[model samples]
Target: MTDLAGRTALVTGGGSGLGAAIATALHAAGADVVVVGRDEAKLDAVAARLGRRARALTCDVSDPASVEELRSRLADTAVSILVNNAGVPGPVAALTDISVEDWDAVFDVNVRGTFLLCRAFLPAMIERGAGDVINVASVSGKRPLAHRTPYCASKMAVIGLTSTLAFEVGPAGVSVNTLSPGPVEGPRMARNFRLEAERSGGSVAEAEAAFVSRAALGRMVTEEEVGRAVVAMLDMPGLCGADVDLSAGMIA
Candidate 1:
């Protein structure tokens, strides 16, 4: 068993979906969990569900001022674990049809936000001599999806960031790894597909089926599955700097 007792973890986007799962998993493993998101009510609800081990904070990962405030709230306590799980799936559109604003919005949260949060928390980890930084990327990072150009580009950037950060921080005892989840079935996924279905004049079920059929697994992946993978990574020793794919049989 990977013991994480007494460790302090900060998970961005913890108010919903995979972020919530990661936060819950970390808390269940005895870590002091801090859940961060833009929704204070949602964050509080998640924290309440997580019991005494979890703390909720509202922070917009894309905002530097909010992040600076978050750092101030943490004071001098060293954060042993940081999970950059906050990301926007981006508006679905053809590459040529994508608006500049949409592209910037996607990159701002997925790339710039991830970079800033790491910058804020990493120095303390370096000073402490050990830490875990889990960046929740996607299989889209490795393979592109049509009409998801901006999201693909942002995730690819995340993979690049993960690899580079891992190389730079491994020497300082900070293990940075990326987890790429497949078609995780949840509210967020449903919302994304719903929007696409509306745009394309198709049923949500059709959109979902299309997504599942694209995966070699022949089904939509579950939140629990992704959660387990994340918990597994956090528990592994000598598991730094790896892009572990949880895409079922998608690669083959």
Candidate 2:
């Protein structure tokens, strides 16, 4: 079991979905968690549910100024665990149909945002000689997803970043790894499926079914499953510079 008592963990995009679940799991493991996201109310709601062990902080991860503000606010706080979960799905369209603005938006949140948070918090972890950084990527990064060009590209960048950071920081006793989830069952997944259905001239149910068919389990992965995987990653001391696939056989 991972004993995180007396540790402070910061989870970006912790307002809902996988981020919220991760924050809850980390708190349950005895870590003081700070949930950061753009939706203040959502963050507050999650924090309230987690009791005093959790607190909410509003932040737009894609914006440098906003990330800097977060850095300034937590200047005195030592974050022993950092989870970069904030990300955008990007526009579901072919590469030819995707505009530069849309592609950049996805990269800003999924790549630049993770980079900024690591830049802000990693030095302290290195100085302390102990810390964990988990970057939430997706199976889409490993395999091509037909219409999600920007999101796929951004996640690939995340995986690359995770590997590079792990090598650079491992000597300081800081472990950096990427957790790539498969087709998760959630509102976000539903939304993406709907968009795919429309683009393919099919029904949402059909699209969802097709997605499940690709998975060996013939079903979507749960948010709680993803949460448990995060906890497991934190508990494993030997894992570093690795791409942990929580994709239910989808990526394999």
Model 2: which ten-residue window has the lowest total lDDT?
243-252
Q: Candidate 2 deviates by what RMSD? A: 0.8
Question: TM-score: which candidate is best?
Answer: 2
Candidate 2 local Cα displacement, residue 117, angstroms: 0.2
Question: Which runs in model 2 stand beyond 4 Å of their true positions?
Answer: none
Give one digit per residue, the lDDT tens place, for model 1 in 1-252. Answer: 456788999999999898899888888778899999999999999999999978998999999999999999997656899999999998888889989999999999999999999999999999889999999888887886878999989998999999999999999999999998887888878887998898889999898888778778798778777877877998787888899988876645
Candidate 2 lDDT tens digits, 27-101: 988999999999999999999999987899999998889999999999889999999999989899889999999
Give the Cα RMSD of candidate 1: 1.4
Alpha-carbon local distance difference test for all models:
0.88, 0.93
* lDDT score, candidate 2, position 37: 95
